[model samples]
Every structure is written in C-alpha cells, then in structure tokens.
Target: MFDLNTLVRPNILTLEPYRCARDDFKVGILLDANENTHGPALSEISETEKFLELNRYPDPHQHELKQQIINFRNSKPNQYSEQPLEIENLCLGVGSDESIDMLLRCCCKPGEDKLLICPPTYGMYNICATINDVEIVRIPLTVPDFQIDSNAILNKITEDPNIKLLYLTSPGNPTAKLINVESIIDLLKRSSSKWNGLIVVDEAYIDFTLPNGSYSQSMSTLVNQFPNLVVLQTLSKSFGLAGIRLGITYTNKKLSKLLNSMKYPYNISSLTSNVALKATTKEGISIMQDYVKKIIEQREIVLNKILDLKYVGKNLGGKDANFILVEILDKFGKPSNEIASKLYNTLAVDNSVVVRFRGNELNCFGGLRISIGTEEENKTLLYKFERVLNELNA
Candidate 1:
C-alpha cells in the first residue's frame, strides 16, 4: 500500500497543531481571544472610512486566496494541459521559505531523517534543514552547465533510506539554470518505489521563463501525474508582492491537507490576503505579464552588454531566470575572485549600484549574479559596471 503516513515522522503524524481563537467564530462583537475591542489610536487617513480589521484574526483557511491562485494557474496554457487544480491541491505559506521549513518539519524527523539538496541552488533549503536539525545530503550539480548529476542523486537516495525530501530549484539561484524536464521525469520514474520521498521543485523565478506568458516550462502541472511532487512558487519575484510574503505550494490533496493542518492557524494576515486577491485579478495578471515581458527583454540586453565587457568571462548556465551569472576575469582573461570582489565592492561602494557576488559558490568562482532591472536601472548598472572594471584594471 502506498502510504504517506509511513514517510511522515511519528511525532508529526500525531501532532495536534494549535487552533487560534478566531477558529470558532469570525463574526461577533467578540471578546473571544482577549483582543482589545477598541480600535487603533491612529487617525483614519481614508475619507471612505475603510477598516483593515486590525482587531480581528484573519481567515485560517484562506479559501478566497487559494481560489484566486487556482484561477491564475488554470488561466495559463501549459504543455501538459493538466486538469485544473482545486483548493484541495493548494496551500499558502508566508513565503516559499515557510513552506520549505514546514515540509522539513512534517516529513523529516530531527537528526534522523534526511533531506537532499543540489547546491549552487537556493541556500534556504540547507538553512531550513539545519534549523530543523534534519540531516542534509549534498549532490552538487554538474559544473559549467549547472545540470543535476541524475545518476549520482539516484545513487545517494538509493543508498540512504533516510532522505525524505529532495529540493530542486528550477531556473536555479545564482546559476539561473533550468533542470531539464525529461531528467526530472526520469528521476521520478526511477525513484517511485525505491524512494518514498517528496520532490520539492522551487519555481520562484518561473515567471521569467514565460516569455510569451506561456506555462510550457513550468513543472507545476506535473503534480497531477506525479504524486510525490510539490511545486513551490511565490509572489515575491514576478508579481512584485515581496512585502506581502505570500507563497504557494501545489501538491496532491492529501499532502495539502497535512501542510494546512500543520501550518499556523492563521498563517496569512487579512491585509496580505486582500492585497494578494487584488494582485491576482484579471487586470493584475495582465500588468504582471507586461512587466515580465519587459524584464525578459532587459535580461537579454544586460546579457549582451556583459558579454561585450573585456573583464567578463563565460556566461555560466542557462539564462532562464531574470538574472544572469557572468564571471569577472582578470586582465589575463582568467576567472579571478579577487577581481570579482573588487568589482562588486567598487560597484556598491563607489557607484551606488550593487550586484550579488557569487564567487564563493561552487563552480561559480569569480561570478556575479546580476538581476534584470528596469531599462533605466539596467543602463545605470551597465555603465557603472564598465567604469568599475576600467578602474579595477587601471
């Protein structure tokens, strides 16, 4: 029998999560949770007299928000043409960070069970595992291309039954590479019975891959076909709602229920939920799509400009994300951490422009990860970068 309970930690299986005071009733002149009945002391700024319900607890289920997400996902045209996901297949977290932490807590027993990660990827996975006291197995991606060493990953998982979660960041961090969908499918097929684990694909930058607003590259729709898959997405990157801290996990209904049950009763605040609803509306999506198109265009421009610079070396990995990774080279045209560090510091300190120095990451020595910004911002960055390189060389 295929049982999810067997994979979950014993403590988590019997865990009785905290129920907030607002659970019993939402509408009342409620003195239920010892909350102050008196409204805030601040003066009302709006002439229309709008209240943010600061005195009350937000919805525990976030039914309306999940419905909005479902609508958003279904609206996209995907290669799989999978069935539209209902609320049962969705769960919201503060950000993908929260969801990562939750998954580690629910499935992996502290100090006993393990989570596997392909580094030169998201750092949060490793950090979350450490925080939860869960063991982590590192399988670094193949250098240059930044592709997953599928055979090595499979070998590690097969050898150790303790690994309960495997994290793969699509359009990866720093590298900006997309792991092939066929490779993922092959891994899924091989690990089906041998490994009773979840494959968590973080698609935080998937929006950039949608050049024409198509979902052809997203593995989110694969959740229906692969029961062990959980795709994590966020409003932070594309939708420009980083401050609201809204993240989503799309998975099978059973896992969704468990995640929801384990999460804080009211994980999302009323204000955040309301803003997210507005952002996910038809008009909001159109605006977001237009912004994404502009970003992709800017990314291309930045990539070409960087390549033209004498100090810049190989453009590592696939440039699918809104960022590009380029190595900073010495005068002799070799990757140099010293040169990269100097350039990064000069850009930030002298030029008032900053790009991430990824020189310390594996296989990314002397690398700088530059995010695609607005046209004016990109031009400023390029100009600053050119001046900095000339100064460093001089």
Candidate 2:
C-alpha cells in the first residue's frame, strides 16, 4: 500500500494550521480580525467596484472558487476520472511555486530526504528544494526528444528509498515537450512497490496541449485514481492571468486536505479570488480557449518562419507549448552557444525583441526558446531575429 503519512514528514503531519478570523464567520460586525472598516484609502471618484472589499479578509477556504475549478476540469472533453473532481480534490496557491515549496516542506526531511527532478525542466522544482534544505537527485531526460528515461528513473527510485518527491514537467520549460503519460503511470506503479514518494507533474502549459486549448493529456484525471499523484497548473499561460498569480493543485482528497492544512489562512486574496472565479466560469473559459487558438496559430507561423533564418539549425523539442526552441548554427554547421548568446543579447539590447537563451541547459546547446506572441508581435520578432542572426552568423 502507498502510505501518504509514511512519505510525508512527521512534523508536517502533526503541524496545526493557522486559523484566520474569516474561518468561522463572514457575516455581521467582523471585529475579530483588525481591519480598516472604512474600506481602502482610494479616490472615492475612482472606479472601485472590483476593489470594493479591501478592508475584509479573503475567504481562506475559497469554497466557490475551488468548485468552479473542479467544474472546469471535469467539463473538459478528455478529462476522465473514476470519481470526478470535488472541492476537496483542489487546493489554491499564490502560484504553482507555493504548492511546489509546500510539497517539498511536507515530504522531504531537510538534508536527509531527496527530491528527484528531470533536467531542463522547470527551475522552480530545484529552487524550492534548495529553499527547503532538501537534496536534489538529477535524472536528465533522454536526449534529442527530451522524453523520460523510464528505466533510469525507476532504477534510481528503487536504489534511493529516501527520494521523497519526484517532479516532472509536461510541455516542459525550455524543452516544450510532454513527458509520456505511460511513463508517468509506470513511475506511479513502481512507487507502490519500490518506493513511496509523491509524483508531481507540473502542467503549466497544459491548456495549450490540444489544438482546442483542452488538456487532453492532463495527469489531473489520474489524481483521483492514484493517491501519490499531484498535478500543478496555473492561469499564467493560456488564461493570460499572470498578474493575478493563481495556481491550482489537483490531487486526491486526503492529500488536498493535507495541503490545505499546511497553507497560510487567507492565502488567496479577495481580488485574486474574484478574478479567478470569473476566469474559470463557462464564459471565461470560452474566452481563454479562443486565445489559445490564436496562440497556437501564431506558434505554427513562427515555427515555420523561424526555420527559414540562415543561422537557425533544426528545431528542438515538441511544439506542444506556446513556444519554439531552435538551435543557432555556426560556420561549421554545428550548434553554437557563442552565436546564440550574442544573438540573445543583440536582440534584447539593440532590437528589444526578447527571447530566452537556454544554451546553458542540458542538451539545449545554442538553443533560443521563443514564446509565441501576438500576430504583430511575432512578425516583429521574426524581422528582428533574422536581422540579428545575419549580423551575428557572419
């Protein structure tokens, strides 16, 4: 049996969550929590409808928001679950970063336990491990395709009983490739017998997985089936809600409760919750889907046009996410970090057409990760990118 308590830290299991004033009551005179009853000090003449309740604390539990998210996920065309998502199966966070940090804290025992990560994935997994004083066991994804090395990961997990958490990124950062679902399922199966660790699948770009902006391959559907599985998602990418900093964690009900217990009371602000609530509604989701359609169209346009550049080599990574990773070629027709770095700097400093330089990452030599932007923005990027490559390639 996969025991959640065995995997979690003893202290975290016993830790009492902080209770806020909003927990018990939300109506009548709320003097329990000190606040400016007069409301936010803003211009009375200003449009303050959205920012109306600045004086009152946000709902710590966020019942309505969580229900909306569950409905959204369950309504997806490909989202399958034996027991459909419930409010208890969801936990809200500032961003996926908070959930990552919380999981590290809950499972890893400082310097003793280990957190496994696949290289060229999301950097936050490694950063959060460091912050929580947990050691990282790096298992680099197989080269060229950037797919998971299932055998290698299983071997490592079996060898190290101390590996408390395994972080996998779908449509990964820089790589922009989805780790195979079968591989993930295999890892989860092994955790039952060989190891007892939580498997975190970060799906920040999952909304862009299908052409229709649906997370057809999302690991979220498996959360109800597997207690050890935790799927992380956010509104930052496809939803265009980065400023709000809303992240959703989908897992089993018990694990979700544990995560809720560990989080600070009133973590989700009133403003954020309001915006997120609106965004997850049926109409809001339709708007987000339309945006995804536009982005995918732009992504393809950029991919085809970018390859035409003289210095640009073969495209790297699957174009599952809203970005494209292409190599910079040298005079010898080999991937060149020197040319890539120079082009990255020249574009940002001179042309202001900024993209990421991911040459430093494993197997991503001379790589430039370009995010798909608006139609006009992409045109500008292509124009500037070709101009810079011409100057640098020579």
Candidate 3:
C-alpha cells in the first residue's frame, strides 16, 4: 500500500486547488500567473547568453534580488528611523506561493497543529496548510460586508493553542475589502497583550485600493513592532511583474533568516531577479502608478454597470480594490449556480471574455468575482452579463 503521506506531504495527500485556468485556453498568453508575456522575449544573442546560465545552477542565495526588493519597499530607514532594517531580515523565494508553503513547514508541525484563515480569501493558504499536515480552522466573514472579526478569531485561537499561523488577505481576494487597520493592531496585541507564531498578511491587491490607498497604507508599519507578523507583497499585481514570479515577505530578522534557510537555494532565478529589479525601479513605479490610476477608473465604471444589471445583486464588498464581488440571483432568488455556469460557458467559447464565478461559496454562495480589463473588454463583460441576466430572469 502507498504510504500516502510519504508520497505527498502529510497535509497535502488529498487537496483540491482553486479551479483557476480550467484549461490552457483559459490561460491567456500565460497571464493566469500574472506574467507579462509581452516582456522582451530573447533576441538571437540574448537567447544565447540566457541559455548559458541555464547550464549552471541558479545562485543559491538570491543576493542581488534581495537588495532590489529592500530598496523598493523602503522598509525602515524612513525619516523617523536612523537605522535601516538589517539586510538579513530580507530574502527571496520562487514566489509568494513558495514563501507561504515554506513558512508553514518552518512553523507548523504535521497533524498536530492548525492554521486559521478567513474565507472568501486566498485559496493557496489553505492548500499549503493541508499539505503540511496542518489543520485549517476557518472563520467565515459575515454577510453584506466581508470584514474581519477579531473577537471570533481570538476565541478560536484561544481555544486551540495549536494555531500556529493566521493567514489574512488585505484588499481581500474576490471581495476587495481592506481589513480595518485598527483590528489588525488589536490582533498584534491579542493575548497577554501579545501573540506569537506566523501571521502572513497577503497584500496582493493593495495596488488597486484607490484615491491613494486611503485605508491601509499605514497598516504595514506595524511590522517593526511585531516580531511574529509577516507581510507578503508581490510584484505580480502592482509592479506588473507577476511574470517574474517574484513575491516578498516583510518580517523581523529572526523569522526572515529562518525562512530563507529553510527554502531551496537559488529559488529566485537571475532572470527573474533582473526583471524584478527593473519592475521596481524608479521609472517602473511611475508607469505602474499610471496603470493603477487607469484600472481604478475602469473598476468604478465596471461596478456601476454591474449594479445596473438586474441579475447582479448588491456588490459584496466595501469596493476598494481592482476587482468587485457581486451576487447573482435566480428568478426565485435561490442561489444561482446555473447563471454563473452559463456566464463561464458563454464567455469561455472565446478566450477574450473571462470572469470568475466564486465557487463553493459558504457564506457568499451566489456571487461572481470580476476583474476590470480594458475599456472595451469591460463593456463586453457588462453587455454579456446583462444579456445572461435577462435570459435567466425569463
């Protein structure tokens, strides 16, 4: 008999991934991973040089890349602090996904410990936890607003001291809610006036929060005071370098070095590092900000149109991120999986139109999560959505 746990890690022996990229056709020019296929593909000479590096092993310690991320985030060394955060507090991994898994291995023991996740959040955290033999305790967000509940979270953690990690998504996935900063500060202060273990804050969509990141920009500064807190930022969403597969974690020196030591060396490639360096360069920030401004403008236009459609119920979130989560209803108003199914089948006929039906929703079961694309593309989705809604109503 297969000693199943040995083949796959104890936690991951049986795991189901988010149904992203249902097939190759759903993956547009490899954008599913947030890569820039438009990035310069190799010229003849450039191709030859890159091929040479492929022969040698990647740099075990991603030194050059770590320096680049440190400079870009401007962590510490602000006007308030004379000393910059030590370089040892920083390291690079294959992507934020890699960091997520690595941290679980470093902290959570197999089969005995548990991790907490607030649902309608990122799926990867759950996936990583299960594979590590770590049990997942879910705290579903209440309806209408997908806000975090500090009391509920604390109660669960207090009950299970085995809770080693708390995975949170800010500008949360699908929902787009920037969790209350004060609530997070309270979490840092939870228990004996404090807590420990890993707290991974995924800021994947922080770029999309608009009118200048009004809600959560200052929340990150808490890292300096909390030794257990770790923030995962990625070039994927904001820097437009998701293709580089570059993700960053901001934590104290002790945790950072431990994560670095545990990961496979040369996890971050030279090509990826070079691209990430360019992605965060001063010039790059200007371009990214420009794109962000356009996307936020486009996101608003899309939200208004979604509200206009009879099929879409109230938008699910507080409306601060690039994408919006809205409910889809049937004629009798029972949870409408059929309507979402139709949207997927119709849009997928051609790869141009793609919106995700938030699947297996426990609390927000009938919603669809839509990303704002080009002006024309947004209109295409709106038009198709309205037609489908009218048809479903009939």
Candidate 4:
C-alpha cells in the first residue's frame, strides 16, 4: 500500500493552512479581506479595465483556468490508454519553483528528512530544499552523457528512507539531455515499495524535445499507473508566457488535493489566468506550435554553426531541449574553464550577447549553455561568439 500520508510530514498532515479572506465570501462589499472600499489609489491606472477589480480579491478556485489547461494537455496524443485527467489532477503554482518548495514543505521534515537530486540539472531543487531546511543528497549524473544513475539512486533510497522526494529534470538544464522514458519507468517500478517516496520529473522544456510538438513521450499519462509520480511542466518555455508566472503539476488526484490545500488560496491571480487561458486555446496552441518549430530549426542552425568553429569542443548531452551545451577548448585543444569564463564575460559585457557559463557544474567544465533565439538574434550571437573565440585564441 503506497500511502501518501505516511510520506508527508506529521505537522502538515494535521495543520490547517491559512484561509484567505476570499474563502468566506467573494461578493457583497467584500469586507472580509479588509480592502480599500474606494478602490486603488492610482487614478491613472484605475481607469484601465483590468484594474477595475483592484478592490476585490482574485478568484481563489480558478476552476475555469484549470479546465483550459486540462483541454490543452489532454489534446495531445497520449501513449497510455489511461483515463483522461480532470481539473483535480492539476495544481497551479507561481512557477515550477513554487511547486518545488511546496513539495519540500509538505513532505520533508526539516533537519530530519532529505531529498535526492542529480546534478548538472536544475538548480532550484537544491535551492528550495536548502531554504526549507531539508538536506539534499547529490547523486551526480553520468559524465559526458549526463544520464541519471538509476541503480545508485535506488541504492540511495533503500539506504536512506528519510528521502521524501527524488527530482529528475528531463531535457535537463545546462545539459539539455532527455532522460529516456524507459529508464524513468524502470525507476518507478523499482521504487514502488513503502521505503521509497515520490518521484518528480520536471518537464519544463519537454515541449521543445520533439520537432513535431507531440507530447507523446511525456510521462504524464502514466500518473494513474504510478501514483507516486509527479510531472511538472510550465507555459514559460514553449508557450512563451514566462511573464505570466504560471506552471502546472500533473499527479494523482490525492496529491493534487493536498497541494491545493496547502498552497495559497489565491496563488494564481485573475490576470495571469486570463492570459494563460488565451495561450492554451486552439488558436493559441497553433501559434505555440509554430513558434516551437522555428525554435527547433534555429537550435539546429546554432548547433551547426558552433560546431564549425575551431575553438568549440564536443557538444555535451543529447540536445533534446531548445538549448545546446558545448565545451570551449583552449589553444592546446583541451577543455578550459578559464577560456570559457573569459568568452562568456566578453560576449555578455562587450558584445551585449548573453549566454550562461556552466563551467562550475559537474562534468560541465568549460561548458556554455546557449538558448536558441530568433534567426537574427542567433546570427548576432554566433558572430559575437566567433569573434570572442578568435580574440581569446589569438
């Protein structure tokens, strides 16, 4: 029996979360929350249509928004024959960051419980764990390829039952490698015991993994089979709605209910939901698909251009995401962190073209992460990168 209550912290299990004023009543003067009855002070902004409800609190439920999300994700071709998900299977967060923090808060008992993570992956998992006072057990991914060591992870879980969550970032950050679907399933099957806890696969960049914009490879459909699995995705990357600050987590209804209960009543504002609703529509999805196609094309172009340069070493990882990771080689034909740092600084400060320097990450020594941009932007980045390389090599 995989009991979610057993995995969660004792305090969180019984604690009543803070109820926002909107919970009591949303209409009739709305004096519960104690807002300015006269409305916001900004006269210039009050005239705008969006600010008309400045005095009233946003809807805490966001039922309509979740339905739109369900429509968008379920519209994709599903690999498994499981029943379609309802709004109950989804939880909205400020971003993937909020979801991460909440998971730690609800499960891991600070100073007692711990979480597992594979490095050369997302940094927020570690950061959030630290902030929540939870210990992080680092199991670095295999070098060069940056794949998770599943066997080691299993051993770690067996050895330490205190590990409440395991974070796996697919199409990994800095590395941009996709952990194989089969490998993920294998982990899920092996970790079904009472000792092992939840597995969180952050698919923030999963939309860019395939050129056809098909999410058939996503593990979202397997949530029913493995109730312990949680898939986190965002509209920030592929939908091009980072400014809206919305993210979705697909999991079993039980866990989703727990997350919803613990999360802020009005976690997602009306404005963000309105914008996200439009972005998830049929026409909006079509626009996003078109954008993804162009970005994939640009990624290939940028990859080819970078590989053609003499100073660029072997490209790292599987290149499943919209970004590419490559090593910067020194004059002696060796990966050099010194050269990579210099090139990164020069491109950003002098050429006004910015890319992340991931030389400090494990197996990412002398690595630079370059995101695919518009054609003209890519050209500018390529030109600046080449000029910087030449100057350094000279």
Candidate 5:
C-alpha cells in the first residue's frame, strides 16, 4: 500500500545528484578540487581553528557524526532496531528546515500534491509548503486540550489521494503537548491506502519532556518499523548547540538516501560537524541531561508563580516542552489581546525580560509563550511580569 517509488516525485527519483570531489579521494596532494593548500588567510585564528584544516572541503559524507547520533539515540529504553540504526538510516541538514523543504520538493509536485497539518502547530510547515507551491489542508486540533483529532484526520486522509505529507509535532510548539503514541500508530496503520506518503513527526522539544533524556515518548525508534515514517530532530534544543545549526532526519533507508541525493553537496560544515561529534558523545549527553533537569525545575517555578497573578489566566497548553503558554486576562478577568500586547512590549523594551505573545493563534487568546531560563533569569522575568501586569491593571 505504501510504495516508496510512487510516493516520491518522478523528477526527484530520476535526479542525478551533484558529486563532490571528496567523495572519491581524501589524501595525497589533494590537487583535485581547487584549494589554497596554504591554509586559511586570516591574520590570526583560534588554537582550535588552526588544526581544523580550514582550507580543505569538508567531508561530503559525515560518517563519524552519523554513527555517533545512532549510538546516542539507540541507548537503552530505546530499541531503534535489533541491528540498530546504520549510516544509511540518517540524513543531516543545515537545520531541520532544509530537510523539511527537501521533503516537500521530493514528494509534492508543485501546485498539485497537498500537505495536511493540525492547527496551532509550527509555522514553518505552512511556510515551507507555500514556498514549494503545494497546497495546505489544515484541521485544527480539538479546542481546550489541543490534541489531534485523529479520527477526523484519518477520514480526510482516506478520501484525499493528493495528500503527500502529514506533519505532526510532539511536545508541540506554543502548545507543548505530546501527541498520544497510540493515536499516531493508528494514523500510520490506517492511512496506508489512499494517502500514500510519509507521516513526518517533528520532535524538536522531545528531550525536554519529564524524566529527562529517557526518550520513551519519542517516535524516532519507529522509523525502522514503518517505511513511511520520518522523524526530525535537532541539536538546537536539549544539547545547547544551536550555534552549530545541525539537524537530523530519521527514516527508512530508501527515503534517507533520496534526501541525501537531493541535498546540497556539503550541507554540514567542518565546524558544525566537529562540535556535533563532541556533543553526541556519552559525556556530552550526560551534561545535556543535567541541564534539562534544571530547565524542568525552573518551568514549574515559573508556572506556579505566574498563575498567582490576577491578570494571568489559566494555562492554555501542556507543560511538556521548555516553554509554557498562559493566558493574560483583562480588568474583567477575560482573555485580552490588548493587555497581552502591552505587557509583551513593555517587558522586552523597558524591563529587558522578553517573552512571546501568542494571543493571535487559534484557541490561544491573550496567551504568552514563555521559555524557561536559568534560575536568575526566570526570577527576573517573573518579577518584571508581575510588576508590569499590576501597573497596567491598576
């Protein structure tokens, strides 16, 4: 029912990937691809930069980094496979953005195929679909709880033969709610007939979930089990490596190879690859887990403190991610966008304690999405928010 060849675009399947010089040779005089050989032209460089061989082209295939990622994700409690994930199972990107775009390009024929999304989800899914000339069919999540309407979505999938991708976010952005695993399994099992495309699960904030780093809630391990499943992740969140701009895609070997074929020749830079290598190591993961613990502790403190304020209404979403979404109330105690806007501006411009105002999003009236910061930073945000809310309400 789920055929890989039929799902992918005819153009992409026949694409001849641009071959990089490094794919063939790595040693000897290295005269193949034009290079300075004299090293970087900077007047001065860091001691670490000196050894990176800045003049040479980075590896076209990052074998070492990919292996590290496989080992890290396959740690106990997560059974990715009996054989475990191999290099062919992964595809690295400049960010998850690249892979997201590539999936649209590789599957959807411009102005023909469609993408299905649940509302109050990530904006990029819509943005990317638009850029690729693909239509978007939005089915808003059920009100109050913000969970997926699995039955409704399945009905649509069964009827629409043109829907090529279904994007689901776990620990969803703005909402922070994780979709029920059984619900997802149902979608995967039932949507095989008419909707013959991939079901992409974006788990950017999954590591921030409770019992940090256990990864029991992640759908990445299911990649091996389902040919049509794709899971996207990044080093930006839990690993504290946003500066390197690395993202990962996990899928069946055929899809992974297709993505690799369609991507830029050297998408991952040397600097990014090196930093990510260290961060994916056992010691690096331990350090990251410790930081996640602190963030969760602070998240609770912020949630309890904000709810006590008169102008702050009840929470709008789950507390699964690093951020919390709470409503800002008016003088009459109803959700108010005017008050939320003023507070958002005053906190960032005057108090230097910034948080996002997401009142405009569906079912998120007068809402503010606040990310958990360090202890001192969280304290400053709560103090400023309370002081400002009172001044405006007074």
Candidate 6:
C-alpha cells in the first residue's frame, strides 16, 4: 500500500480548532469575538423588499458594500475624489475566516512556503496554514504582556527567505494586549524592501481600539502607501454582523485580484451581503462603537472583581479588547490547573456558569479567556467566582 501520510500534508494531518458553536451561534448577545451586541434589523427594507432576490448569485464584485465600507472608513480621498474606490483594490469575504483561507491558497506553496505567526493570538492562521500544507514559524511574545519581538521576527525572516505571509492579531487572543503600533510600523519599514511577500494585519479587533492606538491612524493608512501590505478587516466585530459572515481585505490592486480569483465565486451569499450592508450603516456602526465602549467598561469591572478575589492572581488584560486572561492560584501557590479544572466543573454543575482554561503548552496564556458579558453575566461570573474562592480559601 502507498504511504497515506506522504500523500497528506504533514501540517494538515493533525489539526484541531477551538471547541465553540460551529458558526456564530453562541449565548445571548455575543461579545465573545468582539462582535457588536446589536444585530441587524430591516427598518429600511420595505422599499427593497420587492427587489430582494435570494436565488440569484450576488454580485461577485460586491461593488456597493465595498464602497459603503470604503466611505465608512473615509477612504475616498485616497482614490478618485468623486468615484471613491469603486473596485479593484478592495474585496469582501464570507468572513475574515474565508479571507484567511483565500490568502493561504493564493500565496503559500505547499511544503516549501512558510507563514510567520505570533501566538497567544488567534488560532485560525495556524488552522488555515496547516490545511494548506504551509509551514508556520511561530514567534511567541517576549513577555507575559504578549508584545511581539520585531527583532526576533526580522532575524528569522532574514534567515528564512521562504516566509510568504505574516499573520498577527491585534489586541491578541487570550492575552488581550495590543501588539504595539510602533512595533508593527518599525518592522514593516525594516522588512518591506527585502520581504516581498504579504503582511496580513488582522483588524478584527481594530474597532474596539477606536479613538486610540489603531491601524486606522497608523497601519491601515499604510495599505494605500505600501504595496506589500494587506489589511484584513471583519464586519463581524464592529458591525455586529458575525451571523452575516462579511469581512473586507484591503490591499494594492494586484494582490486584490489574486484574492478575488482564488476565493469562491459567491463566497458571500446575497442575504449575507445585504445584511452586512445594513449592519454597517452610519447609525448602526456607531451603535457598535458605543457598545464596545460599554463592554470595555464592563471588562474593567470584571477585571477588578477578579483581581480583588484572593484566589485570582495576576491577569492578562489592560491594553485592549474586552476579554480578561486571569490566572487562578492554588493553596500551595503553584499553577492552578487542578483548581481551574475543579472550578470549571463546579461552575458548570453548581453555578450554571462556564469558563475556559489553557494548558502549560500555551504557558503565556494559561487561563480562562473570559469574555466580558453583559452586566448580568458579569455579575453572575463574579458570584460564581466568589463561591469558588470561598471553597478554595477554606
């Protein structure tokens, strides 16, 4: 018999994704992935009701929605003043997930190619790279705060010219810290002339960083300024349209064409496109801004409550986004894997609450990536945590 392992890409043969609902469906008013709490409503749909055709294939170009976001981001001034980026350099996706898959297909050569990733970050980059048979070179954060060491990345890139893509998550997963705008800019400048591949900036959480420390001011502007840059933005977060599965990738025209070609012909359904359009309205998007601000406020509350608890030790929060990465301590003052396991069971069975835990392998992020729920859920978590604290203390 032929060797099957040889036939299958080594990276792809053993891949696992985090266990969550298959799609966006989770608990009430999802803020887990930083989606807007408010969902879509058809207040202005009566006029388009008759024209709404579900069976027809959506415009593969996505001319209208792309321009809508372009205008929303105030990107008109870069292109023709009146025309405002009608097409070419911008493309939409089913979600950032599909956009990620598209990039791997378009760029990476199986086995020979590589992608640079920084972890205590999103896992999808690893998942997609593995599926594509692309090697992933991971450079973890230098410290517990989860800041990237650009020098290490630059050194690695110099050694391995095969690095075709770089995947970085801002306000990174689990750690919930901003991977320094200045750090990214410096890296881009040092590597741009030499590294001719792609730098995909995942701005899924950029919305939450509004009014400060975002690519909107620094790196997003670089897309128009630099040819090698690609900004991957998702309406799932700020637009509250996770259910619609709409995301945008911004780059120079050449790369944009490649993504358009490799992507599924109708990656975004008609329903998804129209829903995304509504979800990204002037008023609706602002609502998300307000909503994220509120969630951040609640995140502070949750962080404070957890920090006050004697069982809770140092946490991974404070830079950006809504989730808190908190470490639980044991009586002997070692890692709280046992306590966390016990608390997870107690919270589930006794308190009807749930929290996540990371293993020692993910040493930097070995704690619950506790999302800032609504005031009620936050309070309930606090209550459940307090009970666990009491049990542990005794």
Worst 10 residues of 4 by lDDT: 43-52
User: Per-residue lDDT of 1-394 in model 3, one digit per residue for the tens?
Assistant: 1111332234433333222342324323444544444443444447645643443334556556667556655542222223344467675676789888877886677998788999878889878987888899998865667778888987887777777788889878877888766677667667423344556688887767653333225334445666656778787886777788887777777566556656665577767766776666668777988988888889888998788776667777756677888778777766577776676666667445777888456666677888878798887888877876777578
Best candidate according to lDDT: 5
lDDT of 6 by residue, 118-196 (tens): 8767888889999999999988876766788888988887688778778887767766776777777677777776665
Tell me which residue pairs clash in candidate 4. Answer: none
Question: How many clashes in each structure?
Answer: 0, 0, 6, 0, 0, 1
Task: Name the lDDT of candidate 3.
Answer: 0.69
Error of 6 at 137 (Å): 0.9
Query: Candidate 4's C-alpha lDDT?
Result: 0.85
The CA-based lDDT of model 1 is what?
0.85
- RMSD of candidate 6 to the truth, in angstroms, is 11.0
- Residue-wise C-alpha lDDT for candidate 5, range 118-225, written one tens digit per residue: 989899998999999999998898888888898899888778889989998888888988887778877887777656888999999988876335446777767878
Off by over 4 Å in 3: 1-44, 47-54, 75-86, 192-195, 211-219, 332-335, 350-352
What's the best-to-worst order under lDDT? Answer: 5, 2, 1, 4, 6, 3
Estimated TM-score per prediction?
0.95, 0.96, 0.81, 0.94, 0.96, 0.81
List the global CA lDDT of all models: 0.85, 0.86, 0.69, 0.85, 0.87, 0.69
Better model by TM-score: candidate 1 vs candidate 5: 5
**What's the TM for model 5?**
0.96
Q: Which is the better candidate, 1 or 3, if ranked by TM-score?
A: 1
Candidate 1 lDDT, 1-394, residue by residue in tens:
1258798777777777678667766776788777767754557645322466666667888888788888888767356646777888988999999999999988998889999999898889888999999988999999878888989998999899899899999989988988887788788878877888988899999888853445667777678777888899999998999999999999888788888889988789988988899899888989998999999889889999889998898897677888999989998888999999999988999889988899999889999988899999999999989888977887
TM-score between candidate 2 and the true structure: 0.96
Residue 136, candidate 2: alpha-carbon lDDT = 92
Residues 168-202, model 2: lDDT tens digits: 99989989887787778877887677778888999
